[model samples]
Target: MAQFDEVFDWVVVGSGAGSMASALLMKQAGKSVVILEKAQWVGGTTCKSGGVMWIPANRFMNPGEDSLEQACRYLDAVVPDGPDSPGTSPARRRTYAVEAPKMLDFIVGQGVKMERGSTFWPDYYDELPGGVKTSRTVTALPFDKNELGKDWASKLRQGFLEVPVRLDDGMKLPFMKHSWKIKRIFLKIALKFVAGKLTGKHWVTAGAALQGRMLKAVLDRKAAEIRTGSPVSELIMDGDRSVGVITARDGRPWRVGARLGILINAGGFAMNQAMRDRYMPGTQAKWSNGIETDTGDMHIELAAKGAQLAQMDQMVGFQMSEAPGWDTDYVKPGTQSTTGKPHAIQVDQTGVRYMNEGGSYEEFCENMLVRNRTVPAIPSWAIMDQQYMDEYGVAGKGTAKKNMEKWLASGWMRRAETVEALAALIGVPPAALGGAVARWNGFVRSGRDEDFHRGERAYDNWLGDPFFKNGPNQCMGTIEKAPFYAIPIVPGDVGTYGGVVCDCDSRVLREDGRPIPGLYACGVTTASPMGRVYPGAGASVGPSMTFGWIAARHAAGLGNQFG
Candidate 1:
């Protein structure tokens, strides 16, 4: 019923992983599709991420290691099932478990190269029932951006890593100073760099590689029409059914109609200070590492049309330290390495150890926010000794004389000769600080964290020093050396977690549980199907792409192929 300047079988908003996947599926079905991106760049916040997809029972996994049944059990154990977590119902979880691998296979069939992530990258809750000790994650190999051609390559969003290092290699790079295995990995990376230069290939890794490969495939097929800087301002509703959208083109409003449905893959509101204050209070937008365009415009539009929004307060928390220039850096230096490494422990303002330091980034920041409700733990202090500074350094930077002097001068880090003096500098009670340090030291001696069980999980040890010889537990080491240091750690996030809720088929649902016909959504634009818990690495991206694929299939009259 809406007048249109253009029409397509499917129209996707936001050119993220979900958008790309959905468009690819539509193309495979010979349906006309258009992808509209608000930013000048094509990839969304996904481009700035570590492009990992947690696909359980994927084809690349070793036989007998994973299955759909086990994956469902793991989801049942970890993801909450209640009114508050409606996005992660048993049915939806089952669908995700079953269809995720199919999505991976489809992408691979389309010529995007993918491989299993590190075998050591265990699930975040691997100790739980149905959890795997080894990785179930999938990632794209390092891609040559030249494959996309110069025009498309220039429009692709840049990621944190430009070198051709795999995600596992990047993870191990931090330990190069300690382990011979890491040194060999470094040598291989050096060879890769030389090889790339000689071959005249501009290689990219991480998120960029994943997206670059997908984009190249899409262009090669020439099926979906992709447009950038086209922001969808309104969802054109034909009496409750989303029939089209009002987007900008040529500096004017353009009406685009979809014969099947409009999929909203727009990102979350991590960069919007107002939304952050309303949903997740005590968090600052400046601390978030999400893309600048993730301002939640589509979320507001969807809610205005009676769509149910849930889990508004949840975020994929990435704990960060306020290093010099952290506010302006493309990728803020994270404290996950700092707290999880040896000779370091996080304490509250009252100078007391609260939670396990070597847990997942989501839990790390969630614990900090929850602790802030009673105690002043928003900016928790990470207490470390000279040994930690000498070995692991602080916030991913080497603790050279110049770096330490700069940090000290800028008030980003505090240092002292004794625990008492360091406590005073960081505004903590001296007795409490010294007592906490002594307690931690005692745990190191016994090789057991009786207070919080820091090193009990394989994940904890994976994040710690693998070659630590002095300590029985990889994450347990005495913080007793001289020249103690303290740095403030805050609850930073990759993106917000809450948005309009969707069903198993990726249809946007209203408050009364009825689907809004001709409407679908994926990515952070929808409330996460994993509920409030992060299952493993790439949880967000895996679901986003899978649901996107599901949406396209359903629109094309193919109902739940895997189901």
Candidate 2:
């Protein structure tokens, strides 16, 4: 290992998508780069995710499916200029719009095999301008972990799926549409696993695959080094210009100089309660599903050094609940049962519906905050009938349920024979819930959501149970079946979107709007380019890595117009 005092071309902080992308590019430019990770693992929360990159106009997109003009239109429509958000500006949009395809091509050319995401998977807002039904999202190919050797492979962050199958394989399974064919797929998977074990080949999927490929690319270059369990405590400034970082590793502080620049790719502040309370006010860290390593360490440390911030109230909102049996440190994202399915509705403490039930998780949580201003809507309840439990199942419980006694006994789920009784158990007014259900039933019968248009959009139906035998409105169903259930849901976020503001070149800006020389930032450590709205799946990582690449190129004295 080299001494910490040695000067490198670049010192990148945080070993997430942004960090590795920046480090790889800098190394490609014939510069030395070192990556620092706070956790014992690399990859950060990206490894726990689906590892899809939403790169519009990439090689994978079908002809005419995407264009810069349409993409700009979509950005304008989705993240419009307002008091809350400046919207995604044309300059930033153009930067990402052009660089995304190039970034995808560059990484793929470097040995990262990518597959187009689900053909049936629509953009989160498919009906919005420039939105496509498919091909904008690309996922990494499954990688054999054994290729990296056991010890180094085990250091990578593990995916959330405990199964051996990749996300594509899991999504392609016949269990949903063709249940009879599931046995064949299961048998094939079992045989493949057996064969792999016999051959000492261990395959990892999703985020692990993405990180493995990227790490392998870095290692192949032999010019980049990643140090885990190394937390960069402060930026070492030379006059007004950022020069280096002081990292605390193994109980000792060391000064590592960066001759070119330092890129802060540290993650969001979702796990930092004090930051959440201060910046986000009503939101709490306990409700966020973001990685625990994201404690606003970089944001706090850098803000004290005169870094300007923007969109501090924004977050990548989602619906989630406290993960059962896990420590009190985090919340598990809950998606299926509450929204997109029939026979269920999310309601405030007073049992009133506030928003369309089948909307995106981000929209759902945003509405939660809107209602929380004057009502107890932060921790609302997902009220559903036994039909929902039988058809879609409850949160934390899989689609197949052997018994509901344990869930009900644990008090995490409340069961009652009637809606009124359920409301009583959960402390909501009986009439309000009963009326809401009646209105919901009317909407179901008419194949129209008069109050809240749950099934109006293509994205809404995409999240619905396709096999559900309903009318044209797939997300609608009567909640008349007895033995209703209610589970508490809260405002949850995957990550925060606000931090130090950076220019299109990925240079961090000061309060005076001038670039801070030698200091660059990307990922959640900087305010996102998408502003207040998440465009689609992989929105976070797509911009994070793109800006990272941009930052690396710019710091190397390369032009801002990078391919």
Candidate 3:
């Protein structure tokens, strides 16, 4: 038995989407719950994210378009099996495929509104078996933070987009310069912004919308307590079972007990340089966009208590370029959306065009790290031409004179009159770069990428210039326009993908394959159920919230509601 200053039916560490979901479920079950957040704000990294949840066969999807069998097949094809991918064992994968939709239904039943993502938002590998060209992604509608009241709204973590825009709006906003449809969408968003201001509604979109709605739902119940700036330092153990945790209150050590279980939704170690060096080498913490509170303190505490940690090397890579103010920005400008656009290509330090520039961000950065094993490619260069500058711009910035000068002055961007001169500026062999450009131009003319199959998938085309008039292929365009430019791209991550291993029930598991009683975990705190593969949008948040639901149900003795 452990001494405690307070007790609850459920104690959740971290105020992420998963933590909030579990706390909500516990409260609904008539159990007392508390959420302890290390950060001063609620909503964790999920609030700072795009807030898309990948739920196959969701209610919003057309009936018969997706099913458990189909989703399982897709998972089987993409997520690797065997001991190497122990986190995504056959049983766990099946459980996720089945329970994900149920989780969505449960969340919605609790009054968290959601709708399907873009119809054009295809799976990364749509050509694969069981893959859907239509989206399985679900996202919350834009929410008004004013509903949360001033104090609670002030405590909510801010996201990238302040204005209320749908997730699909983000997909189309990049092409406002090209398409009439995008321009109309932009006009609508602007009008909505004005109307919202007049109505005294402070709207927020993306992750903030999802989290704001959830936070409102949680607070509306008024059954669960949420404490910020309270970090769970250590777990209180009785024999092999976790009974409580040691956290802080009023700058003093405070002990809190859990009558049911303690759930660790405390996120990953993307901000911990020591852990990054040990697990994911050739990566820097500064490049990561994970929230500052994601220092993996819970991971260390879990490991110290004999929890088995696996797949620690994997990260949810979101390839990024060093923009003028990248270091200080809330969400760094990423090159993932830019490198795949027209009139641009990615190459190693030796000026050789490598993997396909378009696809999932995880695969993009995985290829970068893998290529670095053979070539000096850690800081790969994204080579572009004046046409790209004229149309697509660089790292989400316009090609205005001021923006260009600012980038050039900061050395974050380089430009030259010729391809060879550009290569020289970026420290690559001029001849090799020139040859690569010539080869890419030839491919654009032939409409085929013999080297890496650049734009064969629906996803690749989605990341491309839809309004490109000169090329037959949306992703393939001549990089020959004068005043060539180069921007160095690194394998930046949204969050690390690996941590302590858990079972299908979301119970923390030991090396011997036994569950640590009263210990549950979800989100990035555990090795992800997707294994090394990023299936589609919201893969991380989807599993995190689903498993959090599962953990709560198991703790409450609900006995697998989906089962």
Q: Which candidate wins on lDDT?
A: 1
Candidate 2 lDDT trough over 10 residues, lowest sum: 322-331
- Superposing every Cα of model 3 onto the true structure, what RMSD results? 1.3
Task: State each model's C-alpha RMSD to the native.
Answer: 1.3, 2.6, 1.3
| Per-residue lDDT of candidate 3, residues 299-373 (tens digit) | 899999999999899999999988888888889888877899988899999999999999999999999999999
Per-prediction backbone clash count: 0, 0, 0
lDDT of 2 at 450: 82
* lDDT tens per residue, model 1, 1-563: 78999999999999989888888888888899999999999889888899999999999999999999999999999998888877889899999999999999999989999999888898998999999889999998988888888899899999889888888888888778777888999999889989999998888888889999889888888868999999999999999889999999889999999999999999999999999889999888888989999999999999999999999999999999879988778998888988999899999999988999997899889999999999999899999998887777678666645498888889988999999999999999999999999999999999999999888888898888888887887888899999999999999999999998999889999999999999999999999999999999999999999999999999888775533
What lDDT is reached at residue 527 by model 3?
92
lDDT of every predicted structure (CA atoms): 0.91, 0.79, 0.90
Candidates sorted by lDDT, best first = 1, 3, 2
Candidates in descending TM-score order: 1, 3, 2
- TM-score list, all predictions: 0.98, 0.94, 0.98
Global Cα lDDT for candidate 1? 0.91
Instruction: Give the distance in Å from residue 209's predicted Cα in candidate 2 to where it truly belongs.
Output: 1.8
